[model samples]
Target: MQKQAKYIFLITFLIAGLVSQAQVKQDTLKREVEVTKAYTPTISDANKLNSMPEIDEEEADKPTFNYNIKSQPVFSTFSVTPLKAATIETTPPIQKGYGLVRAGLGTYYKPYGEIFFNNLNSKNTVFGIHAMHLSSFGDVKLKGGDKVDAPFMNNEVELFLKHTIQQSILSVDLTLNHDAFNYYGYPEDPVPAPLLEDEQSINYFGTKQAFTKGGVHIDLDDPGAEMDEEEFGFQLDYYYFGTKTEQRENFANLTFNMRRPLTSGVGLLDAGVEFAQVSNITLPADTAIGKTSSTILFAKPAWYIGDEKANVTLGLNAWFILQTDEETQAKLAPRINANWAPVEEILKIYAGIDGAFQHNHYSKIAYENPFVKPDHHLKNSMQQFRLYGGFDGKMSKRTTYKISGEYAINTDKPLYFMNENYYFDAAYNPAPLIVDNTFDVMYDDMNRLKLNAEILYASSKKMDLSLSVNYYSYKMDKQEEAWNLPTWDATLALGYKVTEQLSVSADIYLIGDRKALIIEESGSLIPEDLPIRKSFTLDPAFDLNLKGNYQLTNKFSVFAQLNNFGFQQYERWFGYPVQSFNALAGISYAF
Candidate 1:
């Protein structure tokens, strides 16, 4: 009964809520709108415009490119400079000139001149001529305040010709030389005048030809044998002395050489022969100073073993010496030479052993020392052995070095000595007169040792340097010392290009101590000893030379030379002092 009542109450409540939520209704509210009447008007809405702005077409699209920029060096900024067209440089091309003439004057009344003509017949044949002259006429003051003039003059001329025929070459040379010198060794007031008849002249003529197998058109009968190349030459030398002293010499030589490859082709055979004749003639012949002649026949046969880069030659020199009233002498000397290239074209070593006979004559001696006595007895020098070794190598592309050493033994070697001949006239002269202010030859056995070194450096930028040194040791059998021979010598040369038209060079020369013999004067009278016994030593010497050249035009140039800048009064000879600081300037013209 209770449950039925609860359901009835729930049903009654639901019906009551439903009836209350669904029976309510509301009324609607309305608003009114007002309308206006349409009106028409006349047309006018456009406004006046100001003047149009002007347009700039040129500045419309401006470019941002740059035309001027600072130049930058391509190689290096701080060290290297950029190559560019120079504003102050206006150098012209240097044309080739064939002929040249040079002339100059310097202190001590010295004059120098040279002439060259090399443009003659420039076709297949070439011919040239050269001539030179130098003279000095001033007086030199001695240490004792005595002034004396030792005038000297030299003249030389040369003619050269070259012709090429097919594959062969032919050349000819002709030369003539003359010299004049005076022996003014004493004071001006007390010394007797010397004879001015001392003059020397020389003439030489030579012709040579180089012939190959093909050029000579040689036909071989045997196909296996090869025809050799040959060289032929002829030379004639004549020398004469014109003065109170009469001396003349004539030398003729004929040279022939032939070389051929061996059958194996690994070696070559070389053969050569030289025939020479020497004649000495003197006018008003005295037994002690008469005409004398000699003949020499030399034959050398060698074999070359190795390739072109490295080779060893084994040979012998056979000489036949024939002299007047003397037994014939036959000399046999061995000749050997070896060369090897440890590095091709870069380093090379060479060694050789050779011997020869040197002829001594009046003309040869006078040519070396014009003060030599004209009346000289000629003799021959025999070189028994000479051994030498050297090595040359390139340190860099522009630098090279060479060092060499040598040992030699000689017999009958000629040494220079001051003459002891003098005359004194008590009536005409106050001082003694030296008949000959010259050097005489003395024969002795000698041994020598030598060492030499050289270095050369050259750059592509117009600069070069060369240095050399030589050391020598000599021992004599009969003499106290090797007269006038230096123990050490050195030289340095440097060249630099200042500009396209200018160049300069510097040279340095050094000489070590040398020994010499001088005749002693005992109270204004020369001694009557058979030979001079007094001797002295010469101190070391140093010399500096500077030279420069400036080219004004292609065919004209100016040059200058400065010598002995150190101002050292060094004696080159026993009594003759070298020139002091001197300068020479000259002009050269070429056409």
Candidate 2:
């Protein structure tokens, strides 16, 4: 019963404590409310803001700036010397023509005409054609009344074609030539007319004239901007010559050349082959004529060394020759050349040692001297060695100069000379008359030395001038002199622009004295005896030529040329005298 009561009391006490804690919590959580009134204020100045400001708003006060100016005296002086005037400046006229036609007539019944047409403006292909004709129908002063007319006529036609495609350039050329001349330099005969006529009939040397030549050439090359340089070329030519004495010659030549770089560096190789056949139909087939056919083959391998400032080329040129009735010959020659630029592009020194074989042909001989006798045998000339050195440099701002020297050794060098025998009517008048006009080929060993100098000056405008001089010395074995070769030669050329439409030019040529063999009659009773040969000196030659051109219109121009103004009747060959002073006036039309 006591435990029960204690529990009840404990329970009652816990309930009472809980009840008191709740009542205290309620008392402590009693809510209290505090309220405050909200105030709303109206714009009292609304009417005042709606009106404008009291200050004036239409304008503001004006602003101004002040300036101050000052002055000072200056002094200057002028020089007494005046400034030089500048040269007259003008641009050259543009030519709007693709074809040009030129025709002219001059003294000695000379007539000249030329026609040139070109379509070179095409990007891929170019074509051109040129034709020229020159003729002289003049009368020469001969000793006898043989109605000798020194007539000469030359006609030429050339066609050119070039094509470019993808790093390669190809070109082709065709040429045709016809040349005619008359033998009018025969001397008068002293014998009676009948006897002289009979002698002439026996050895009738008719007017030898006429040469016709046709040729074609083809070239294919790479200029080598991206690769090595390569080139291939070929040429074919046919020549026919006829003389009034029934002398005729036929010649044909075929030549091929190739060049290739062996490596991407400075190594190169070149090769060439030439085949030629010449026939002198006038000679009997059974006679011992030398070399109806000839063939030459050559090869060169080279190495290029050095840089832009200095360079050298070392090469070996090997060649072989094959001719009918002769043993085959082979040779090797050194080709060493060098160039040094001491002052960049302003001065250059060059030296070389070169050698080659120069083959002679009947066609070339007849071309060089039209009066060569057909009975003579032709031979080859070989240049065994040559040493040359030169230097070229700029002298001033507008002037340049060059000096060169050379020494060469040649074997079997050919020279032209008159035959020692003369035909005459010995039964009648014994005096020799009507000398032979035919030349013979003489071969000898020759040594040549030469020195050359040149200077050129070009002004800023209006004028240009150039002068060149060459001196030569020769020593020959088994020959009296080097026939027909000049020892000294000089040339002077001047160009002046007087006005825009008019221009003038002058050219002068000076040639030194030359030696020739003169035949004099020795007291001999036999008609076949050889004549006495004496050395004769020919006078020096001086030639001056003047030319002027006036452009009357864009398509038409007039030109005048005065040739040999000094009126010197010089003999270019042994017996051929060139004409004196001559003039030609012509008009050119372009389209």
- TM-scores for the candidates: 0.71, 0.76
Worst 10 residues of 1 by lDDT: 41-50
lDDT for each residue of candidate 2 in 473-546, tens digit (9 for 90 to 100): 99999887988777887777666768877767676777788776645555579999867876666678777777
- Tell me the spans in candidate 2 whose CA falls farther than 4 Å from its real position: 1-91, 141-148, 186-206, 224-265, 281-291, 420-427, 431-434, 518-531
In model 2, residue pairs whose N, Cα or C atoms come closer than 3 Å (at least 3 residues apart or on different chains), thus clashing, are none
Candidate 1: residue 519 lDDT (0-100): 50
> lDDT of each model, Cα atoms only?
0.53, 0.59
> How many residue pairs in model 2 have overlapping backbones?
0
